[model samples]
Target chain A: MEAAPPESAAPITPVLVAEHLERKLPGDPPVTLVTDIDLAIEPGKFTAIVGPSGCGKSSLLYLLGLIDRPTDGRLLLEGRDMMPLSGDERAQIRLRHFGFVFQFHFLLPEFTALDNVMMPIRRLGRLSLPGARERASDLLTSMGLGDKLHKPPDHLSGGERQRVAIARAMANNPLLVLGDEPTGNLDSTNSARVVELFRELAHEQGRAVVCVTHDPGIAEVADIRVSMLDGRICEVLRQT
Target chain B: MFPRLGLLLHIAAMHLLVRRRQTLVATSGVAVGVGFFLAVSALMVGSQTDFVKTLIAAAPHIIISDELRSPSPQPGVREYGKTGAVELHGYKVRNEVRGIKDWQQILREIDAMPGAIGSPSLSGAVTLRQGGRDEPLGVVGIDPTIETRVSTISEKLRAGRLIDLERVQGGVIIGEDLAERLGLGMGDIVAATSARGVSRSLRIVGLFKKGQSGLGSGTGYMLLREAQSLLGRPFVINRLGVKLPDPYTADAVAKQLEARHGYKAESWQERSADFLGLLLTRNVIMYTVVSAILLVASFGIYTAVSNSVTDKRRDIAIMRSMGFSQGDLQFVFVVEGMALAVAGVIAGWLFGFALMTVLGSLEFPIQGEVRHLPLDRSTRQYLIAAAASLFAGIFAAWLPARKTALVDPVDILRGAV
Candidate 1:
């Protein structure tokens, strides 16, 4: 898959916007982990967040993914205020519209590979069993893990498990996919392959991918790069 | 709805399957409690039913006694001061009721009484002579037509017809033992001699077998008129058999009649109170003991559910992340407990019934009691027990369920077990 930035004049509205977001770590004297971060991710655009280990990049990603609430700012998804939605409604939106990939894959250990991939899709609708099975199989097959349907996460390779996590994130056909150090635990070979998979998902499928990573090679492949230091964004580098 | 319910069932089934031994222990706790409860209750009610059956089979609901004359009065103001002077209170037995002069009139009046049923019976002792042999018999003069209303042995007629006590020349229904002793059978003639040297020749029309009692001492059944005739006491009956209208309230009616009419009366309850009392006492004691089993079973459920909540801490945390409310978590645990209880109840019911049947078939050790144990399921009692069990299961799971729901997802995700 080839990657090229869209024209600067593209008028697509931002799907996620974080304005002056702040989060504090609870302590005797509370420490500020994320402070006043202004960010926006538009539809059909790929962005990468890169910083050192203690830069709060993961916290920023979590806040952007709507899994963690900001201490002092509002989150807007599709320019609609997200603060008023009930917990169940928010979970439904996350399960239906947003996908997340964590460093460890976080696959439910007991379920099969296909079941892990199909969880969000199955949660979204009452599909017939065979229909759900077929969709899950197709997603895994496209990820190059077709024959591992019944295998548990423990039995799969580290890369294979992350691939399952990616297939799961994309299974609900979400508009935005967020990866928190998605290939942090993999070797260089597996890391490059996962980076290529993300590129194909973003450009060919026309979905936005915001990845949090410290790897410069993975960051170079993104069309837009936002770098963070301490708790705030230091620079935004856009490419065409 | 279908998909969610399917998921719920799938999850619950898998959880139970993976912990089969624990589930079995939980189920058996409830099952044993329920089984013992049902078995004991059934046997108690069975005995009660049996007692009623025995009384209905053996004798009438009411018995009229002879109008016993008071011996010379060593009297006072009749103790309660209801009478002003020293009054000789008449002791009435079966024979002396006002306007009940003849056997026919007594039968008519008894039949006409509200809620009253059955023809009258006259009882006396007589010796039946056959050729050179003689045997003393407890002779009863029966109204044949209404014998069933007065006694249970009416169902135990083995041969010939029940004697027509209304006949001028009444036939005798001898017990099998008496018949055997006298070497007499149906259609045979026997001569009966009374205490006062009064004699009558009677034809035996029926032979009865009552298993025990009213027979071993050579009892005889004859027409009421014939017994009165041979005794040279026309229009005189030594005893009267009364059948009340409602079998359930026989004792109350008998009491009312005794108080209102100044005649001696006896009910089936009054006749069999000793046996019925024994059954009631045993039932109360046994059921109280069985209920303790349910108490123990509830504790088992509490332990099982609490341990499950502990085991599924991470799962609960995931569920909370998926936006599960406290109520939702509560529902899951309560449903699990109730499922166990309901399963236990069904299993217990089956086992209890089977156990009762087995106990019923075997010769149980009731010492020398003649009554058999019975099982009965009253609707009220069954509902109370079921409600108690359901409440127990729910309450047992409540504490742990609440704690599980209140757990913060952040702590759980950070590797807290």
Candidate 2:
């Protein structure tokens, strides 16, 4: 716990970094999704990678999140090289230190909200049944979803489902939270609430968050914004 | 491992429950196939065993027939009539059989064979007169002390006492069906004519009814010496009743007797080959058809699993991206199929047992030497069917389960992404 940055620290060692990355789509006419890109995300920073359609913003985020491999690049997380680890080792890293919230909030339809949140912990195989349940309840309570513990995805509204997804991503106390258009499927009010939750998590909990979005309003609220175009990082801006 | 197993089981159960209709359709496919297999196999085995046991109870395991001589050959024709090769010339037809001069010697030789148990019996067509009515019947001479070794008729005595060895003068047991037809009762005296035209009055000491080969109904049993005396032969027998130590050993013993001695010995199975062959063939055909039922039911399982894969495409991709392996998904579907198969086998077994019980109580129609229906061996047949049903169900689900398990998670996700 002491290894984590304090809330008072304005900046610390960058937890995620990608340098000179390139990804090519193998097609009749090959398309380069990312090319010679360099980026870094500092701890406790609410950063958004924004770009137009067909830009490499999502690809760069996916590489930083350790969900996909870069064609020719170096990726480092917490000062450790991400390329030498096996797929299972990478998955363990994701399960332990990183949480992901996808565009669709892919909640298992058959499981209730509490069970969905408990899935990652259970998969870790380190906790007993009651221990996992307790952790799941605590996380849901922290996320202000205690009342919807037993509601299935279909029964829950889109906003509640997204909250459940967020709770699930944070179940293992991950250091970095990665969201890819998490509010893309929600309405304006729900989207604002989701962004507020992200801001609170980063500012109060002292956690790093990197979100990929095309929405300008979301980018405007971020402490740091990286704009990408044509598979290259065009500019980086900081809020005063 | 245990925790993973628990999680997998919970996940499988939830999926099955959520897709209740699909699960039911899959389970019912296996159950109905197994049910028909069990029912048909049980009935076939039961009927076949019943037929064989009933026939054995009424007859000996082995039968010996006296030799029959051919007519004298015509002059200037090199024609010899033999067992397999009979040459015919222009000669008058005549049959003159040599009497068994050394009857005691032959009986002793037959008894000396390994596992051979024999009793002398004399048979001939005779007219029996009782209460001013006459009926033609086949007369049999049996040694009372050893009669039970070959035939089960003694245990089926419905009225009066069985034949007594001490009463050597003359004692007879007549079938109940024959007794009824002749208006004869126990202890009634009936005059029986022998082949030599000699007549003797015999007491009906017992009456019996046989389920199969109702030769019991139209048969008369008397003392061996009495039959020989009535036929004007001092010591002669028309046939001998022979039984081996075990019913399955009859053929071996028969082969030995034929090789050692120049006498033709026939096992009961050979004597009733036509009937036994018919039953065995019917059983094979029926079992084949019932097993094929499962072959058809597997198609339903294939369709159900294929549909499930199609419906759960997105879920599969998410699971794969979350680190679930292909082997894991394989295990999931296997668990589903195994659950369905187990339920089907259990249900089919219970249903088969119930059917057997009902069949055991009901009377079947009489046909071609068989009167009673048998459900005694149904349990064993049901067990065989249950095993076959399970095997077929598992095999049927294999192809579909593999297809679903191996579908590229990345491809599925990319198509829908």
Best by TM-score: 2
Q: Which runs of model 1 end up more than 4 angstroms from their true locations?
A: A1-9, A20-37, A48-63, A68-71, A212-240, B31-38, B55-58, B62-106, B109-116, B122-145, B154-240, B244-246, B249-295, B298-305, B319-357, B364-404
TM per candidate:
0.73, 0.80
What lDDT tens digits, residue by residue, belong to model 2 across residues A9-107? Answer: 554677777778788778988889889887777777799999898787777777777767777888878778889887667767877888878788788
Local accuracy of candidate 1 as per-residue lDDT tens digits, B344-384:
77777777767867877665554344544565656554565
What's the C-alpha lDDT at position B164 in model 1?
A: 45
Provide the TM-score of the second chain in candidate 1.
0.76
Cα-based RMSD of the predictions, in order? 6.9, 6.0
First chain TM-score, candidate 1: 0.93
As a whole number from 0 to 100, the lDDT of residue B246 in candidate 2 is 76
The alpha-carbon deviation from the true structure for residue A63 of candidate 1, after best TM-score superposition, in angstroms, is 4.1
lDDT of 1 by residue, A108-226 (tens): 66678998776656556657667777888999999999889889889999999999989988887887898988888899999999999888878898788999998887899998999
TM-score, structure 1 vs. true: 0.73
Chain A only: TM-score per candidate:
0.93, 0.93
Query: Residues B174-252, candidate 2, lDDT per residue (tens digit)?
Result: 7888888888887777898877898988877878765435564677777777777776665677676787777777777
Worst 10 residues of 2 chain B by lDDT: B68-77
